[model samples]
Target: MNVSLNEVEATAKRAARGAGYPWGLAEEVGKATRWLCAHGIDGTNSLAQLLEQGLAASLKNHRPVEMQSAWAGQGVLCPIITGALLSDRSDLLHAGPIRIQKLAVPVFLLPFVASAARAQNIVITHTCDLFRAATDGDRLEAGQDWPSFSDHTQITLGGQLTTPRPHVTRATPDPACWDTLNRFAHRTYAPATEESRLLGAGAGLSDND
Candidate 1:
């Protein structure tokens, strides 16, 4: 079904939180997912897939580890965590391109990179295999071959900006993906109880007035 970007963000936030991510990270996921959808990427499915993996395995395994010239994890890296770290230490971009190996859902990292670029007032380029993407804080351009998952990727601080892609106000998420997100988001709801349900009413179970 067609939905507004705001709807996507809210649902993504709740889903992330319900999937065991801290509120702060969930908030990040919300913004990132919205950004992706606006740019015509399938962020809902990516987030749903990530949440499924997180629920099925230890998130610690996805934590990034520094290597000689790149970062790697025991398993595929979670883009949300990695993206936050990049935003936190955006200055690292000054040294050189940040290379991350075995990154899951690399597209989700774009918003974080774009945010960092806007903050630093610079252009950034992200590449994996044949896929290429670049953002200059305001505008973004990516190859049509953007992959669902990337085994290895590199991000650089400076690059030539491409023509901006028009953003949409609405997104039509895949039905299966939307259902998965709802399942995760549902975990945040509290079970209904009799007292809670009757709290707002002036009378109890039996109301004659």
Candidate 2:
């Protein structure tokens, strides 16, 4: 029996939600996996297909174990899981650039890369080509401007420290102009009439008493 990619995607989404990931995050994972599968990453597709097959124990067992290879050991790297791991350990990865070789389902890994970059306050570049990094790194200009993703392959990630503009400080004081206020405060009232004084409260009526 075969299943459509959409169905697999739906199932994966449900499983992710059931497993306790927030709806928004689960949705992100689904989209990431789909992107990876679209890019011909076998692991991404396999995960989708596995989900459609009911998430059997054997399928769960097939999840890729993280190997310390240059590119995930040239096997299918589950981007969904990898992204989760990266998000969890982002602080550690931020200390330096980390590389994964032969990454399976590489597209799925993009969210994790982006999350790590944002968390570490830096940019991330992932690619199969090595020479491009050296040349691009030299040619690339750095500034406070954000990086664009025109090219998907051969990623070169970095951040620019934008120089802040100097602020000008000036000394000033409030202008003096308040004849209206002075008039109001200095205004005097006529002494109360005898009839008014009799009705007035307390001391106003009885100065001597």
Candidate 3:
């Protein structure tokens, strides 16, 4: 059955908690899965269905063997597990972007991608195309009209997107003025007067005997 995004998120969270994942991590998984689904990855829907159907047993058993088989015919990938794997394997995956196809619940996979990117100090570009190509260690150019998060079908490293340059320019404040202000503040303070010095603590006191 088709599921709504909210339902998918809630179900995924519940499943994550039931599966012994921390609440905070479960929450993150929910959001990450939602993002992936929104990007047309079917993450939310797949996760929700998995939760309702109690697919944890399959996942646990499959994890010990070929974890990828968990989603073999179900067309539902677990984003939480995938993300965790990515984070753990960041060192190995850092050389370049990696692509996986036929991922069920693909939306749930984004956090892993993001985390992996961060761990490797690279950027991850996700493409919805059949190839599901991701770019690592690249920079996005800033653009005048920024694209919406959902609009980005392809993921890239640091430079995948760019901010728009403002056409209107404003004059910068003068450095000389700042220097003058600093000089004035310094001048406002006077050397301690004799009277003030006399009253100062330890002015006439000495430790030397």
Candidate 4:
């Protein structure tokens, strides 16, 4: 189904919630999808892939993100949780750049870096396309020197102290992107039971005159 970009974000948010992400992280995913869509990148497909593959389990179990190791048991780090930790303890970046042994869906990881740039009042950089975000959240600076997210299994990310103002741009996502998210979103709705349906919204009212 073709949907507005706003609807795309809202549905992904609800689906993420139903899929067991905490409300806060779900909210982040929503905004992230919208931002990516505006950039002409399909973050919805990346999010759906993560859910279908049950990647949240890897995230839920891997807390207290550290620099010395890969996620325990799972070979890759969950970006939502890892991103949260990275943002929360951003001071750790002062020591040096950190590396992830393997990261699933690199596109999903960029939003947090953008947010960190805004929150910390500095420029933030990440693995995907080597994009850098400004502190005002007004720009994403990138050059053609970087590779696509699909080409990498792991990456290094860090921050720079510079901040610059640049023109902003956003575009509507393709219809195919909306369809991809709906495939997983359909699984999130609860099946209505007989009793619940009888008492559910507008259940007791009828139009008969």
Best by lDDT: 1
Models 1 onward score TM values of 0.91, 0.38, 0.43, 0.70
Which ranking of candidates, highest lDDT first?
1, 4, 3, 2
Report the number of clashing residue pairs per model.
Answer: 0, 7, 19, 0
Candidate 1 lDDT, tens digit per residue, 151-175?
Answer: 7899898888656788888999999
CA lDDT scores, all candidates in order: 0.85, 0.41, 0.45, 0.58
Query: Considering lDDT, which of the candidate structures 2 and 3 is the better prediction for this target?
Result: 3
lDDT of 3 by residue, 1-209 (tens): 34465654665565556654567766766665554444444453344433444344465532212333122224333445545665677675444444443444444455566666767786665554433334232222121121111211233344343431232112222344323323323433568987777668554554556
Candidate achieving the largest TM-score:
1
Better model by lDDT: candidate 1 vs candidate 4: 1
State, as a TM-score between 0 and 1, how close model 3 is to the true structure. Answer: 0.43
Which pairs in model 4 have colliding backbones? none
1-209 per-residue lDDT for model 2 (tens digits): 23344643454455555444456656766554443333333323334332333322232332335434232422344445556666666675534555554344344455455566666666555443322211111122212111211122333456442332222122111112112212222322356788776677556655784
Global lDDT of model 2: 0.41
Instruction: Output the worst ten-in-a-row residue range by lDDT, candidate 1.
Output: 54-63
lDDT of 4 at 74: 42
Model 4 lDDT, residue 185, Cα: 65
Q: In model 2, how large is the Cα lDDT of residue 84?
A: 67
